[model samples]
Target chain A: MMCENQPGALIKMDLGSLTQTAHDPIHLLPCEIQYDGHAAVDKYFTPTICQGVSAKEVSFRGRPLKGQEIKIPAGYIGLVVEENHRPCSEEEGRTVCMKSTFLSFTQWNLETLPSADDCAMMSLMWPKISEAIHRPVDSEE
Target chain B: MELEKFERNNWGSCRLSSLVPPLCRNQHCCLGIDEAGRGPVLGPMVYGICFCPLSNKQDLEELKVADSKTLSEAERERLFEKLDSLKEYLGWALQILSPNVISTSMQQRVKYNLNALSHDTAIALIQYALDSGVQLREVFVDTVGPAEKYQEKLKQRFPELEITVKPKADSLFPIVSAASICAKVARDRAVKSWKFLEDLGDVNLDYGSGYPNDPKTKEWLARNLDPVFGYPQFVRFSWSTAQTIVDSRAVPVRWDDCDGDEKSSSKGSQSMLSFFARKKDDTKHQPHRFFQERKLETVKDL
Candidate 1:
């Protein structure tokens, strides 16, 4: 079931061939959704529907038609099903399947990402990081 | 019968009289003498002598006597006390030369005066031992100077005594090592007393442990360009470090003014000036004209 305008709602469908367009739109409603398959979804939709949603075909409000599957775009943000939710494998003995796997959301703002070289250099110099950060004590006998 | 035959063949039986400890024939007395603190830059030089009867050889060995440097201060002190109580005669002499005397004397004679002073102290200790009823037929001194010269000097001081000045006599003779301990301990005590005067100025104003390459001493010298302050009279001022300090501060014009007039009026100066003038007149001659002339004259006469 889909509400035209609800504050928080979940959308689950195979999104394909969805097209919507609008100009001079002032506001947009965002939604969280799940896709059922791995096929690529493509469409031309209203800028409002594509503004916050990172998927290429499935828009914020429109639903996919028959004979189509949904595909999540790269850098999108959503949840995936996992058997365990614990922080580490050593803690699996506890209740509620204490391990969980995480798939990072693909919706990163490209401008804010550090360069690959910067990331590599930071990891290379990590061993001496403590020495650079620690201050010597002033009082010594 | 076999036991009698074996006994007759034994070398011990062949000279049974020699088996008995040889009796003292010459009635000679041996005195072991040693001095300490010669190399130390900061303290007094001390000489000590110890004498014991030849019959008490076992007693000296049982005391475990050795060179003083080989023993810790505590062991030396213990041995010193035991030797003092056990030996019938002992004597000590200390020559305390102030830094000023050591410094000035070193300039003129290059530590000759210091060696002489140490020898004088050693000779005095031997004399004292002899005075206390110890026979002086044999005197073994740890050599400080030429053995013959030192013996000659000692002879001049005590003509009646026979002196044997041997290098490293302390390590060779246990008696000399015992005397070494006494002298070393006495000098160490004197150095400890000097600690009281440290607060008057830089504690390192005196040379660093009197050993070369002491950073504190070098640092002190570098900081104090003038040699006057904090250097006690006990130090040898003639040391090259002192001379370097003096040279660094020397006013060249002042030295010239002091000696310039004397140099101009001397007859020897007039003769040297005339000789150089005549040598310059022979322009074609080699620069070593004086040396060549002496060689040629010797060759011609030959």
Candidate 2:
């Protein structure tokens, strides 16, 4: 959503929260993420999944997999799909890249998922920590 | 309140707040008004009014308030702070007369304007104090011109409150002196801020000391002598010396043929030369006449 003093009328969503919910195997086959605004269409797969695969080894819809690297950890599926078929210009200038590595994968079980109370407590405590980090220092004598 | 004790000494003491009859009785707040830089050859004339409650009469008396000239600058500054901090009120009004105004207005007329301005400023301050919840009954001013004239002016402006005017009131009354200090300090600050001599090179003048005999002041005048520079905006150009300086710097071609006019115009230029001339003329006639008369009397006796 938009708020006063925000530079542009765009909403920023965190990919980390979506990745945690998608890690469960019994969660659902493919969940649809519906939002108000546009999204990217390119599907991205983690580098670990494409490690030993060569170009033309995997193909989908008569097109060979490009074996492109994904910056996120393995088993985390992330992609941007636009609701409209509008073309967008590529982002220009300097950019910072982030990398995440998965050490191991635990068995996904829906019964072992966090309770609603635990999830609520984590959400509430996370903001308090973030607020404490962003608060200004009092310099008055 | 009593003048008996102070009569024996040249410098007297009195309660400043109690001088005004209404204030002494604690009926209402009293405001004393006075001005500075009226007779100065330079600087703007500043008028100031100070108000205080009758209860603090003793505190004001303890400070020994006197005319600004009588007190040292440090002492004036100290009392200034104390008066400012005390339960009192103060207001200031300033009028900067250019050399042109001074050159045009008669001396008496200038005094009238200054007195009228001071009375107006006092009334304004009194009204301000009243509006701020102060109950004021009277205002006292050290008269700059005739007491009757200032009294008339004050009455016209503030018909509701009582007004008192007296000669040398700053010396006779303590409150007037406090007002004098306030006016003087304010006027001095104004003069300091002015850029009268900014365009004139090399000559440094400080408020002209408000005195005519200052040498540095005379030098400043001599240096800034052009139609464009004119008389300094702060100076009282009505004074004869201002005109004389301006005339002295006039183009030589204009009065070059008239030596007599030049000499007369240069009158009062050298204080020492005039003094010696007067001394020589006095001794030449009186001493010789007495000696000749004595010699004739002796010859007649023989």
Candidate 3:
């Protein structure tokens, strides 16, 4: 399926020096939250992590979440983007700014560990695979 | 009745106490320990200790505080109130363990069982009373597990005090009967005033005794189960009754340690060779160990 915005929103991401500095680690949670606006994640979701038998255990809202920190592959950079405001009209293309960067993020599972079956961990492998697949092939071969 | 502690964080256990009887503190006192709601799949388990001057044992008997299990809810309430009226001669303390705490502790990686939790709560209540200057010379406890072992454990903890543990101590000892009443009444109140942290609308308070075998409780557990979240914090998630409902009704959650070793045990040195031989034709497209472990694949479209 293809989705096209007629006057597509243009996200002008500035991966400039200001945004290159590392920020706090990110976390990918299993559950979906209804609201999408800014949240006081630092204040409310301060995770007290303990090492479990096979994973890192954390309690979020009285529920157990287990996972581990996954680092970005070498020679790769992760950028965090944020929009200043919604565009007034469709004609006014959206501009999202790069807020910060991160080298690693914690991937959480609901009462489980981040495993090969998790889509987030699976998706992270793209850069390494892409780099190998797109490499120059010898004409002699 | 003094529930100000719950106001801070409702999910954790809290202690409540009656005034330390001024006269009882100076005299040789007998303390009794008992617990309520241990069989329930819902609500908190309360450990109560009731103590009074050894001379006031007759007063407790006169008040007709029998085994709480033998009394109706109404009779228990009346007797509890009567006991409260004689607060000048008696004192009581309760350690209320929240369902959340019970569930979390039992389900920990190290696995703290219910019996250990109960023993600890009972011990804590006794220590708290002693620390508060109760002249406790003897303690009577309704046994959990083997009577001898529990008695031995308590004797080790408080060698000075005479500790007696028996299965039906509540029926034989008036002070223990009084402690049972305190535990039962406090458990009832805790269940009655429980507020759901989840946004469950108009929850039915009548969960019917909360015992696993109660039909009304079984139905309540079935009806109240949320497909994704399982049950509210009121339910003991570690209870097999709650776990069965979750297994059948809730979404599947796979923990890493559960089956990790079992899957790898069948494989040996030839596993890598077998894998290479099986997918030789598609080796170029095959994902690396990192991707395979997380079950990831390259996207063909956005």
Q: How much is the lDDT of residue B60 in candidate 3?
A: 84
Residue-by-residue lDDT tens digits, candidate 1, A65-139: 111112223343223322323335432232222122222212211112222233222333333544555758568
Tell me the tens digit of each residue's lDDT in model 3 across A60-140: 434567888888888887777677787777666665567778888898887766787577767777888778889999899
What's the true lDDT of residue B241 in model 2?
63
The Cα RMSD in angstroms, rounded to one decimal, for candidate 3 relative to the true structure is 9.7
Worst 10 residues of 3 chain B by lDDT: B293-302
**Model 2 residue-pair collision total:** 2
**Candidate 2's error at B260, in angstroms?**
28
Query: By DockQ, who's the top model here?
Result: 3
With candidate 1 superimposed using the best TM-score fit, by how many Å does residue B273's alpha carbon deviate from the native?
Answer: 9.0
| Model 1 interface Cα RMSD in Å | 51.1
- Predictions in order: lDDT: 0.47, 0.48, 0.80
Candidate 2: list runs displaced more than 4 Å.
Answer: A1-141, B1-27, B87-133, B206-208, B251-302
lDDT of 1: 0.47
- The positional error of residue B14 in candidate 1, measured at the CA in angstroms, is 57
Q: Rank the candidates by lDDT, best first.
A: 3, 2, 1
- Give interface RMSD for all predictions: 51.1, 53.8, 7.5
Preferred candidate (TM-score higher): 1 or 3: 3
Summed over model 3, clashes come to 4
